[model samples]
Target: MQIREARADERDALLSVHRAAFGNTEGEAAGDTIATLAAELLDDPTAQPVLSLVAEADRELVGHVLFTPVTLADQAVQGGYILAPLAVLPGVQGRGIGSTLMRAGLEQLRSRGATYVMVLGDPNYYGRAGFATGHQIKTPHEIPYPEAWMAQELVSGALAGLAGTLRCANALNAPEHW
Candidate 1:
């Protein structure tokens, strides 16, 4: 398997993988849509310091991960990012594609001077990638899933004494039925 930045032509295939990987989960349909919009918006020229990576095997896309700008309520802390919609095709799960995508994406973000990275995901999965609960860092986002809402500091002391709501690019509204 190989990992690389996603090309324009691969969007649909990546979306297909996302749908398939997350389709059965609760609230995933709308999450998938939001993820797609986030990816598209991040590609806009005006967007700064965004990173999206994909993993492929035998010429078929297998996984995707995205990182975008985020901020703490305190203006002093800048260059934060959010990780969302990490997806690996069901058939490809447990093959390390997700981990590879995350490592590469986080490295790229750190190299670009990102201060911190936050993710809403399984603690066990993300914890393996160096993520810890926001409470550990005093994150302001009062995330409902305390355990699932996590953050990692790329730069030492990046999140020190910081607190604020963790808002997505667009104040994402959950679907009515959810």
Candidate 2:
């Protein structure tokens, strides 16, 4: 399988992958919401420079992930990013597609000068990819599952002394997303 930045025309395929992957776990309505958020995230002014990637094999899009700007309430802290809506087609869930996509995405973010990355996901799953319970990080958005809220430093000491509320991209600011 190949991992790369998704093409503009591949938006629908990305949505389909997320809808199928998330729908199985959270019902069709939640899937639909994520798909909608995918589109909205690209257009949201507060979410400039969005990173959207896809995994392909045999000419089919099988997995997808997105990383967008996350800011500290205090402007003094340089803006970081948050990973959300990561999805792999249901037919290929256990094939390491998600992990591969995540590693590649994080690498790209680091090259772009990003110091850290955050996510709201399963500790068992994301921990293997390097996310830890963000002890020094915080978010204003009331997360339903705090333990799932985690972060990772791309560069050593990236999270050192980091504090205050995290402001996610506009499309992800809604409480339902957490």
Candidate 3:
């Protein structure tokens, strides 16, 4: 399998991956919601400078992950982003496609001078990717499970002294999303 930055033409395939990945565990509506979130985030202007990556095997797109711009309420921080809606083909879920996409996307973000990356996901899953509970940073809306909100510094000590509500792209600032 190979990992690379996603192309504009792969938008539909990328959304489908989200649907399939979420539909298997969540309901179809849940899948559709996440897919719509992905689509909206891609078009949201505030989400510019986003990092979207895909995993491919046998010439078929199998996995995808996205990181969008974010900001701290009081700090003029640069290179802060949030990871959302990572997806992988249901048939290949057990494999490492999702993790590979995340690692590749994070590396790209770091190369672009990202200071830190945040994610709202399973603590165990994302923890393996270097993210830790991020209570120091806040989400736009109150998150029911605070433990799911995680962060990782791209630069050493980047999270030091950082504290405030995280303002994400408009599409992702909703209460339902959190």
Top lDDT hit: 3
Query: lDDT (0-100) at residue 56 of candidate 3?
Result: 88
The true-structure Cα RMSD of candidate 1 reads 3.3
Candidate 2 per-residue lDDT over residues 14-125, each given as its tens digit: 9999899989888999789998888889778888789999999999999999999887887676648899889998899998999999999999999999989989889999
- Encode model 1's per-residue lDDT on 1-178: one tens digit a residue: 8888888787778777777787745467854775565556556553445677889899999898878787654455677888866888878799888999999999999889888898878899999999997544433434556687788989898777777655445432232211
- Weakest lDDT window of 10 consecutive positions for candidate 3: 134-143
lDDT per residue, candidate 3, 53-74, as tens digits? 9898998999999999999887
Q: What is the lDDT of residue 63 in candidate 3?
A: 94
What TM-score, over all chains together, does every model reach?
Answer: 0.82, 0.96, 0.97
Model 2: worst 10 consecutive residues (lDDT sum): 134-143
* Local lDDT at 145 for model 1: 66
Each prediction's RMSD over C-alphas, in Å, is 3.3, 1.1, 0.9
Indicate whether candidate 1 or candidate 3 has the larger TM-score: 3
Best-to-worst ranking by lDDT: 3, 2, 1
